[model samples]
Target: MTHDLVIRGGTIVDGTGAAPYDGDVAIDGTEIVAVGNVSSNGKREIDATGHIVTPGFIDGHTHLDAQIAWDPMVTPSTQHGVTTVLLGNCGVTFAPCKPEHREKLAGMMETVEDIPKHAIMSGLSWDWDQYGDYLDYIEKSKPAVNVVGLVGHCAIRYYVMGDRAVDELASDEEIEQMAQLVDNAVKAGAIGFSTSRVEGHRIPDGRPVPGTFSSEEELCRFAEIVRDNGGGLMQTVL
Candidate 1:
């Protein structure tokens, strides 16, 4: 049988807890057609002599949400062989933002993650105001890597409480609003939500990010929101 492509004689590490082996891999379009001993000819062939062929890496935590807009390949992460990345980590992200709130979110990401504030501000198109729309924007940009996103509490809190988010616990109504926003994000495409409680992760004014001082009741409310959504990843930094 003829295949679309074949890689011959590479050391294969397939990431299945299997031992390394020298073999041939044949591909038909996007799918792997054969492995081990592929005797069929291919439309294109690569001599993988003295090389390694392995599955692409997955990075579960990355802050490439802003960078993806300007750098579709997402830079160093892709250079290191990662093909999939999870964005909106560490309770910092650029969505669920009001137009007036864009600068605040950008500044907070810079404070905690050291991403350049100017780059974030100027680089992105700033088209979306919600987490799901942010994801849609990411897709529209056509990044080289597959992207997964987690809705972030910092953005949620800021969107709801503005500057007071850093210092005050959310009001009952604010918490409910936050829950509704998170539910909308998940329904749109978010796999989960994230927040930070560690003292070190603070915004530009040296205040802790919004979720850092969350009361148990507040945390439980968020948990319930995700639970009712059939469960989702809750990434909290502590």
Candidate 2:
């Protein structure tokens, strides 16, 4: 059978963090059909001699949540060969937000990530109000690279507890509610929960983020939820 594409004579740096080797890789449609001495008649061929062929890299940290709505390639990261990115760090995210909270979230991102609020405001589409809905919205987008996201504690807190999440400690009842929200997000495909307490992140109103004042008990409870879920990573800036 004829292959759809063939990469001939390349140094394949298979991303095992190991050394490189010379080989040929073959592709059938979107999947890599074969590797090593791939003898195939192909419609397209790449002369990859002296070039490196490896699995795409992932950016562990990036604030491309808003930018991905407008620019899916993520610019410099893509240029540098990052094919995947994880967003929603330092306790900020655009997901699980109401339309009325667009500016509020944008301001938080701008202040925490140094991205301009106008840039976020001009670029993003605030059309989703739940974590799952937000993921669906972005999935429909034409992304040049794959994107995975975390549910930010600040956003979840804001969505659940509203304005009170910032100034007040979460009551026992509120903490349980927040835990449920996080649980829902994880089941819906959020990678995990992220929160910030670095004293550096402040909202436009000059207030620390909601999770900044979150007690150790609150954060530990969220972490427990993540651990129980079988797949979640907590990112805290403290």
Model 1 segments more than 4 A misplaced: none
Total backbone clashes of model 1?
A: 0
Candidate 2 Cα outliers beyond 4 Å, as residue runs: none
How many steric overlaps does candidate 2 have?
0
TM-score of each: 0.96, 0.93
What RMSD does each model have against the real structure?
1.2, 1.6
- Clash totals for all candidate models: 0, 0
Candidate 1 residue pairs in clash (backbone atoms < 3 Å): none
Looking at model 2, the pairs that clash are: none
Query: What TM-score quantifies how close candidate 2 is to the native fold?
Result: 0.93
Local error of candidate 2 at 137, Å?
0.9
lDDT of 1 by residue, 139-237 (tens): 989999889999999899888899888899888999999999998998898888898988999888888888898888888888887888999898888
Top model by TM-score, which number?
A: 1
lDDT of each: 0.90, 0.86
Which ten residues in a row are the worst by lDDT in model 2? 65-74
**lDDT for position 119 in model 1:** 93
